[model samples]
Target chain A: MQQALQQKVQKAASAIAQECFAMRVRYLNRSLTSIYDEVFRPLSITASQVNMLVAIITQQTLSPSELGGILNIEKSTLSRNLDRMRKAGWVEIDSSQPGRSHTVQASEKGQALLLNILPLWQKAQETTCTLLGSERSKAIREVADHARSEIMKT
Target chain B: MQQALQQKVQKAASAIAQECFAMRVRYLNRSLTSIYDEVFRPLSITASQVNMLVAIITQQTLSPSELGGILNIEKSTLSRNLDRMRKAGWVEIDSSQPGRSHTVQASEKGQALLLNILPLWQKAQETTCTLLGSERSKAIREVADHARSEIMKT
Candidate 1:
């Protein structure tokens, strides 16, 4: 019976490994993330952090909740990232608004980092585009847009 | 001068937000991971863990480095995950092989969990396909394949 179960599991696992969409998505994610992360390593910032910095700077000032929503990050994860960015002096609490709610704005240092990041980001982008090809790149954008719209509906 | 620099950063940030492939891939990854994660929450496992488990079980016994290569995971990250799985009794260290090389295999409990995860995984897959649409799902597969091929080349 034990041998039979192992065989069953082996068969099922093979199928899952070959066909699971989430698995493929995750593998692709790790691959792409590594590519961008490696490129951004010299800047001492991750691709995810760069995304957050861009979002935070673009808005000028927004509450953590708003930033989380924009980034589709969970509250706890958002808080953690915010804390790290704050420690890095990339973001500051906006105290101008009087209330219990706190907001964040990119620090001057963060803005400078963003400017410096542009060229490196472009290099990463070019590498990714060349790897995935133009067709796949377009497809990724469409799928991402579809996922974003679905999030909005919820 | 500061104002001009800020304007330049803002403009650059805006472009990055809309055009960056890495950002879009990350967003889609987060969205899809959340979907699978929520579906598997009751199982007390994550989509990522499920993928790892499947890979481990299929391979029967492999060194940590081999598993990391298969999953494209960093050594530290892979070790941390293996520790968690070991503590949870989902996998076991195989000491039968001699030499300094250590190998890992899914325990009976892990095999059982994989069986239980199948139906819930199917549900998550269906939801993802519906959200992404048929065309986009195909696109995702193609892009993921392309990424995998690139990794193999490297």
Candidate 2:
């Protein structure tokens, strides 16, 4: 009976190691983030910050909550990043024109910074695609989109 | 000329929004971690903790750097988590052993906790696989493996 229980425990540990989606995803996240962070380090911004700037620029104007939703960032994290970006002259928040929300948009400095970083960002993207291989990259995007839709349904 | 520059900036922002791998992976990471964390919450452990326990159990003993490399966790993050697990009585570290590194393994209590949490962890895995669909789940694993290999080669 003790041996059977040990076997069961071993089986469970092996299964968990092999099949845990969160663990695998987190590993990928750490690995990919490390790669991208190294790529963008010379540009003085992290990968997520670049995404935030892109989202802000793409939208032109978004309330904090809307930005949070778009970026899928936590409210507190979004607020903190917005504060940092505001301080960095990369974003402007118009709280006075708000009804319980503030409008966020890229400042002229932010836009200029984006322009400056565009080449490096492109290089980073190109490096990622090349490294992951075009086919795998496409598969990742497809899976990501499908997973997002399915998760949202639940 | 000004209009052309604005168009270029917009194009850059649009490109980033469309093709940023780091952002997509982070979204998936956050979503998947949230799901697994919620599933594991009642067990008084996070999904990452389960992974740590599994790694410790499977290896019997590993140096902190070895464990971090296996899990792809950062050095500081791994150190902190190991400290927490030690405090929780889930892991035993033998610093008395020779060399600069300590050996870590799951304690009896930790092994028991793993047995206790196995069913819930299986449920989380099943739910994720079902939600992602088998094909996409498989794709995620394949892509994750390929990316890991590529990143490690650098």
Candidate 3:
């Protein structure tokens, strides 16, 4: 029975390694994030942070939940990142807004940081595009769009 | 000059929101990871930990660097995860080997955890596959393979 269980587990492991969608997406995510992170290292900001800054600045202001929805970040994770960004002067909260939850917006420093990040981000983007090829790059965007739509439905 | 800089920054932000591959990938990664994480919550293991466990058990043993290479995890991140896994009694180190680096292997408890995780993992996998759809799912795997080959070359 023990031998049988081990064999079954091995089979399962092989299947997951070969065919799991989450595993592949996650692996690709890690690889791509590392590429961008390396390029953005001098700025002391990560790719995720850059994405957040862009979203915040573009929207002018957003409640935490709205930012979380746009980025697909969970509440706890989003809160932690926002706190870090606030400490870094990358974002500020507007508690004066008429709502139960405060709104977040990019601070002046954050806007300045994004300006500095543009050239470096372009280099990282070029590298990632080259790595993924145009076809897969397009496919990823489609998948993310699908995810967003599905998430909105719920 | 100030107006020009703001315009340029706004343009950059809009472009990134629309076309940045890293932004989309990171968003999808967060979304998909949350799906799997919610399923694996009962198991007290995360999707990432499950991935690490499978890799560890399949190889029977691997050095920290080797595991990191396979998972595309950075050294600091890998070390931190491993520390957590070790504390959880899921993996153990075998320092008996003749090398500067110690080898890591899943403990018996880890193997049992995998057995328990298989069904839960399948549920998460099916949910993710449904979310990504068949075509994008296959594309993600292909992209991951492309990334792996490129990384191996470097």
Best by TM-score: 2
Q: What are the per-residue Cα lDDT tens digits for candidate 1 across B44-71? A: 9998899999999999889988999888
What DockQ results for candidate 3?
A: 0.67
Query: On residues B68-99, what C-alpha lDDT tens digit does candidate 3 reach at each position?
Result: 98988988999999999999999998767677
CAPRI quality level assigned to candidate 2 from its DockQ score: medium
Each model's lDDT: 0.88, 0.83, 0.86
Q: Clashing residue pairs in candidate 3, if any?
A: none
Give me candidate 2's interface root-mean-square deviation. Answer: 2.1
lDDT of 2: 0.83
What TM-score against the true fold does each predicted structure earn?
Answer: 0.92, 0.93, 0.92
What is the TM-score of model 3 when looking only at chain B?
Answer: 0.91
DockQ of 1: 0.74
- Indicate the docking level reached by candidate 1: medium
Winning candidate number (DockQ): 1
Output the lDDT of residue A87, model 2: 93
Off by over 4 Å in 2: A150-154, B151-154
Give Cα distance to truth, residue A102, candidate 1, Å: 2.1
* Interface RMSD of every predicted model, in angstroms: 1.6, 2.1, 1.7
